[model samples]
Target: MMAISVTQHAHLLASRALGWLHTHRERGALPPGCTAELAEPDTVYKPLGETGLAASLVLREAVAGSTELRLARELLDFGWKQLGGGSMLHERLLRYPMMSDPLETYAHYARCGYRHEPLELLLRHTTSLHSTRAAEVLPNRRLAVANAARISGFDRGEDGDEGPRTGSTGGTDWAGLTAATWLGALPEPWLIDWLTAYSMTHTVFHITDWGRLPERLPDDIVRHVGRWLPVWIDIWAEIGEWDLVAELLIVDNCLPEPLGDAAVWERLAGIQHEDGLMPRDGHPVTGDDQERFAAHHHSTVVAAVAGTLAVSRTLGTR
Candidate 1:
């Protein structure tokens, strides 16, 4: 078998790093400054993480208008059927804490094919994920209503658990960040469908609860979330997923403004070693620095530099 290219190797390493992060989180072994909680056994699983949410928000902001609205409607129709009919894990999905943009939500629902029955069922199922009555109830209810209104308006026939139609159940099976990018790729008509599917799986579990989590979250939720984070990040970076690229850029941009620090840029720049390799760990170096000039010539380092530059330029443009 042909050896993996330097770029591929870098991505592999990055995936490992992300896996480590996820493992640490799931095990409740995060060092500090990170917060995630476990899921409740009785509750459903949703995959919405901060990174995913941020990416979604950015996508929504970047592509807004009638084209997107129409796409959202189409997606909502498909997503509701897939989710509520039990083809997808609807119950385990976590609802967004804050109400999603109303227009976006409506667009998503309009595209989802399920009518009031499944929509209502999804709302109820999602609502039950919360351990406490007061915790996520209101937000869930609101989302349910918003989603219902959107789908209800578009429902043209009897609504029930319609299984996947013939030749309708095949597509790429990208998980984590890879899946996120696919959603980002959809045109306006399909965006909501992708988002609806995404929201169900993009949750970030809190490893520890500081009086904020529901009364009964499963112990493994945090670990699972942490284990998946690094992999997702690596996939996002490797695939040139501009959604995540924009998110990182936004974060880097915001960091400097709030802290009055240019060091953040310098730090990111510094990660490039003199040889061009971007090691998963070790000291930070720049691609052009002389102290490690020889290092820049290495193929692996060069590939890393390319990835770093890609990320940097994306951020710079934003």
Candidate 2:
């Protein structure tokens, strides 16, 4: 293998990671006749959405090279098709109007120019209902809905500069919803367990629209994250929790002024398989095709997101 600077390491990491996702896109497929009414959406639907989320961010940042870009678009297509071309989302909303996953999943595709008119209309109407707001959900899930809603024209954006990304009007206060999240509180640092760490990273992800708008983050929140995120990154990296490490790395690049830790980036690149898989931990990744995909697909998506943001932020700074 050729030598690489840390920035180049990030570039290659992104392309390779996304390449793996495109090749294994089928691994995330739902079973035949799957529907929104299914009891466990996580087994397949959630993975598809997460994959789309990574691919959409790659397109949105316009940071990936031509190969990565093509793969990203293909990944989006696969996700949309897997959802029965948005019919699943519409049916999902019909089944459980209060559910946010469909809207959240649809927004990932919409931001990248994938559209489903029926889903959009229903999302607009359903999200506006008083019950949607009244739905008892975790605060971070609420933030996810707010971000997705804004992206899909169901609500206005955080900047308030533009109306909805589409034609819809009136929505949640992005600022208020964010404040309700765990990270928004900036509570005692020692209180952050592994789960809270994931929550904090996601809060960063949703608030910044996966790093497209770092300016949307408040100064206090930024400072709070900046002050403590390094410690968390170091702790996770030490434990071989490569999945969480990659997420914290993405959070780093999302900051108004990123740490741009070259050592960590290089370390991540070194550990990634030649085919672009990033193991979830230091253990050898093993399984049948399906088991491996199920076990560590998330870490790989996170690695892709991390590397993509790292490159984009560096170029943006320059």
> Cα lDDT of model 2 overall?
0.84
Native-structure RMSD, model 1: 19.7
lDDT of 2 by residue, 56-147 (tens): 98988887778889999999998899888899988988889888888999999898888888887787678767778768988887888877
Candidate 2 residue 252 C-alpha distance from true site, Å: 1.1
* lDDT, each prediction: 0.28, 0.84
Count: clashes, candidate 2: 0
Clashes of each: 44, 0
Q: Give candidate 1's whole-model lDDT.
A: 0.28
Report the C-alpha lDDT of model 1 over 59-158, residue by residue, as the tens digit.
3333223443343333333334333343223223333322322222323333333334443455443333323223343222333332333232421112
- Residue 298's lDDT within candidate 2 is 93
Lowest lDDT sum, 10 consecutive residues, model 2, at 161-170
